[model samples]
Target: MKIYTKKGDSGETSLFGGTRVPKSNERIEAYGTVDELNSFIGLAASYELSESGTKYLRKVQELLFTLGADLATPPSSQTRIDRISADDVSFLEDAIDTLEENLESLKNFVLPGGSQPGATLHIARTICRRAERATVKCANVDDISDNCIKFLNRLSDFLFVIARYENKHAGVREETWKGKQ
Candidate 1:
């Protein structure tokens, strides 16, 4: 099938249930950011990382797809899509706790750079924050599930911890930020 469905050429797109909205819609912004975050996660996964790090990232990518779908389908639509759930948020929290066990407690903020994968994870974390903000903005105009925002919030923390873990395993020291004297 040709991927070019010129239907969106008019600067509009269809939601999951065949509802059409402008590409600038808040739902589009939220899901687009989620898609961006997913791509960054995939990039981070391509770099050298522990087996567990790669595995968890894979899971995160899957969850991001679910979130994107949830954002794409409006509550008024009859389309059925799996949404971000409390369990999904819990999964991120659990992963954060596990990764943090191997990381030193943060006494100060750390700069966002390290091994290749670690740095990529940091980039993903920032994108996750943007996704969260976009999702919140979308919620202001639409009936967004609260768990969607919660998952993004916890996922940012998870990304932060995992980035530190990746740097630690790569033998890279984290540079803590010291405010100007």
Candidate 2:
């Protein structure tokens, strides 16, 4: 099928079950930002990552697709798909714990940079936060899944730790934030 479906030309788009709403709808914003996060994560993964890091990023990218799809679908729709669960949040926690083991204890906030991949991961982290906020707003007004917000929270933490890991793997030191006096 041709990719161009002029359906959204009127500033409205359909949710998963063909319920149309403004493109600016909270649901669209939520899922769209998740899609943005997925793209940046994929970018981070394209760098010289270790096999484990690569594998982990691949898993997260898949999860983001699921999240985006879930967000796109209205809760009342008949389309049944896996929504975010506590187990997904737990996986993120496990990853953060694993990666944190390799890094020094944090005494200060981190700068959003290091190796190229590390910097990109920071970008992804910020996007994840935006996506989380958007999802929260959506959840506030709609019957969305609560686990989606929880997953984004844990995933942001996971991204921060992985950024440190990427920096360490590249032999680049993390920059701790210091006030500009």
Candidate 3:
């Protein structure tokens, strides 16, 4: 299929099942943020990462596509797509639990800078938050899956933990936020 369909020239796009809506539609905004998150994750993966980190990130990237599709396809649509589910959230939680086991317990807010990969992960975490908020807003009016919100929430936590793990593996010390004296 050609990339330039010119179908959206009028600022309208089609959902999965041929439902046309404005590009500024809430569902579009939510999945657009998700697509942005996926791009950042791809950038993070381009850096040097541990074997497990690389593996998990690859999986997360795949799931984000599913999430985007889920958000794009409303429940009323006939398109059957894989969607965010409880199991997906659990996967993130499990990964976070495993990675956090090697890190020191958190006693204060952690700063968002480290090695390149670690810093990129921190950036991705913030984008994840924005994506989650957009998804929440979309859910308020659309039939978005509850798991979509849950997955984004847990994914942010996963990104934070994985950032620390990446820094630890790279021998970079995590800087904690210190309030003004």
Candidate 4:
């Protein structure tokens, strides 16, 4: 099959429900950002990490495809939609808790740096935040599932916690942000 559908050359794209929207549609942005975040997660996962870290990130990447599907399908459509669930959000929270067990509590604001892998995870975290904001904006105009938003929120925290875990895993020191002199 040809990768280029050429149908989108008219500045429009089709959703899962076979409905067409502009390429600039908020829903497109929402799911596109999630797709972008998924790529970054893959990049971070490519780095050296613990077995559990690899497993968790792989899980997250898989779930993100579901999230992208959820965003791509409109509620009005009769298509069978993939919806985010409370369990998804809870998984992120549980992962955070598990990773935080070995991490020091924050005394000051943390800077996004440590080892190369940690920085990569920080980039993924920021992308996750942007995806969340895009999803929220999509919610304003469409019937986006609240669970999807909640999942994005928790995913960012999960990324943050994992980044910290990566730093500590590398025996790298976290640079706490100090006041600008």
Tens-digit lDDT track of model 1 for 1-181: 9989899999999989998999999999999999999999999999889988988999999999999999898877788889889999999988988888888888999999999999999999999999999999999989877788999999999999999999999999999998997
Q: lDDT by residue for model 3 over 1-181, one digit each (tens)?
A: 7889999999999999999999999999999999999999999999999998999999999999999999999877778899888999999999999999999999989999899999999999999999999999998888977789999999999999999999999999999987997
- Enumerate residue pairs that collide in model 3: none
Give the winner by lDDT.
Answer: 3
Counting clashing residue pairs in each candidate, in order, gives 0, 0, 0, 0
Give lDDT: candidate 3, residue 126. Answer: 99
- Tell me which residue pairs clash in candidate 2: none
- The candidate with the higher lDDT, 1 or 2, is 1
In model 1, residue pairs whose N, Cα or C atoms come closer than 3 Å (at least 3 residues apart or on different chains), thus clashing, are none
TM-score of each: 0.98, 0.96, 0.98, 0.97
- In model 3, which range of ten residues has the least summed lDDT? 75-84
Per-residue lDDT of 60-138 in model 2, one digit per residue for the tens? 9999988988898877889898887888889899988888888899888998999989999999999999999999999
lDDT scores for all predictions? 0.93, 0.91, 0.94, 0.92
lDDT of 3: 0.94
Which run of 10 residues does model 4 get worst, by summed lDDT? 74-83
Q: Give the per-residue lDDT digits (tens) of candidate 4, residues 8-36.
A: 99999999978899999999999999999
The runs of at least 3 residues in candidate 2 whose Cα sits more than 4 Å from the true structure, single-residue gaps closed, are none
Residue-level lDDT for 60 in candidate 4: 97
Model 3 stretches astray by more than 4 angstroms = none
